[model samples]
Target: GAGVSQSPSNKVTEKGKDVELRCDPISGHTALYWYRQSLGQGLEFLIYFQGNSAPDKSGLPSDRFSAERTGGSVSTLTIQRTQQEDSAVYLCASSRFLSQETQYFGPGTRLLVL
Candidate 1:
């Protein structure tokens, strides 16, 4: 797809399980970011991958949350030992560069941990 795309638009998992969410950003976009939106938190940044530089993971809530982008194109966010609090909409976005004014956002993946 030409635009950013995410797999498994909806995911339901039990607490203590692990889940991997995927994202495919627009071609040639050099900056990619992961975010989570929940009831308490409107929107929070999770991770950011820009080009070959080390990803900025300061936004991650804990060690259980991790993400990686390969070939500067596809990225994956993995949550290990998921908890009920981990349930939220995982969003992916990409831009030609971090300085770009406009970012392309994917249809987020809704995760429900029971």
Candidate 2:
């Protein structure tokens, strides 16, 4: 793809349900990140991955939210036992090397937990 792309542009799930959001980053990008933005709020970082390893996950709001990157490309964010607070736009971004570089963002997955 030309840039980062995410699957299921919109997802509606019930409370306590599990959801998996997928992101395919730009080719050759080494760093990937997961984020979420709630209504009327700033973007909140969730996780960061260098290659296939996640070194920074301090931003995760709860243990129910977990992410993984495989083959340094596609990444998945799994939200288990979703709650209304978890309803937000799940965003994915990728950079050339590290977090300091410019990041290309995907369209984002809109997750609505009711």
Give the best candidate by lDDT. 2
| Model 1: residues with Cα > 4 Å off, grouped in runs | none
TM-score of each: 0.93, 0.97
Number of the top-ranking candidate, with TM-score as the measure:
2
Q: State the local distance difference test value for candidate 1.
A: 0.90
The total number of steric clashes, by the backbone 3 Å criterion, in model 1 comes to 0
Q: What lDDT tens digits, residue by residue, belong to model 1 across residues 26-94? A: 999999888999966778988888874545778999999988888988999999999999999999999
Residue pairs in steric clash, candidate 1?
none
How big is the positional error of residue 91 in model 1, measured in Å on the Cα after superposition?
Answer: 0.5
| TM-score computed on alpha carbons, candidate 2 | 0.97
TM-score of 1: 0.93
**What C-alpha RMSD separates each model from the true structure?**
1.4, 0.8
